[model samples]
Target: MKKVLVVILVAFIILQFFPIDKTNPAPTPGMDFLTIKKTPPETAEMIRTSCYDCHSNETAYPWYSNFAPASWFLKNHINEGRKHLNFSTFATYEPKRQLHKLEECIEMVGKKEMPLESYFVGHQDAKLTDEQRKLLIDYFKREKAETERKMSF
Candidate 1:
């Protein structure tokens, strides 16, 4: 048991050497969804608190992100989230893609699948209340409608 414990401790220490890259991409405010869409302040704040960490270039890494295995998982998760939807570069996406992404936002928030449960473990403040979810859903719906309207012209 003692040997096993020693080995585990050593392995854990070794893992710390492989830190995840914490460099976030540079901000592009002109192209950001919040800026381009002119999202309401309240709704934008909610989105920033809950969604921006993973979904935007402005990731604010938490303390745990300094650790290894957890950091690796977090980096992978953030990369995947950005791949799916990068709000920092929202205006760069084609109009149809933007509309589709807004639709996705409505679906994800309405279904309460966003701000993943694991995220809440580290970020309690990021948790959305029922009212906040409704607000986000409504905001996304409105954005989608606006996008569609612009696409028609």
Candidate 2:
């Protein structure tokens, strides 16, 4: 038992040196969704708190993000989240894809599937009130309508 414990401790210590890269690339103005859409201040704040960490290029990493196993997990989740929907690169997506993603965003928020429960566990502020959810859903609907209107013309 003593030898096993020693090995585990050594492994934990060694793993700390194998840190995952958490540095975010510089944000480009053209890449921002807000630049193209009318994002209300309150709604923007909610998104910043709840979604930006994973969904945007400007991820404000927590201190624990520098720690070993947690760092690896955070890096992986962030990468996956960005792959699915990167608000930072919203303009880069094709119009059809953007429309689809916006719809999905509304559905996820409406169903309370966003900000992932695990994320809210550490970030209480990320939890959305019913009103916030409605606001987000409305925002997505408006954006979708505008996009469709523009495409029709």
**Backbone clashes, each candidate:** 0, 0
TM-score to true structure, per model: 0.98, 0.96
Q: Tens-digit lDDT track for model 2 on 36-81?
A: 6868888888888999999999998888887889999999999999
Off by over 4 Å in 2: none
Q: How far is candidate 1 from the true structure (C-alpha RMSD, Å)?
A: 0.7
Q: In the order shown, what is each candidate's alpha-carbon RMSD? A: 0.7, 1.0
lDDT of 2 at 58: 92
**Candidate 2 overall lDDT versus native:** 0.89
lDDT of 1: 0.94
lDDT of each: 0.94, 0.89
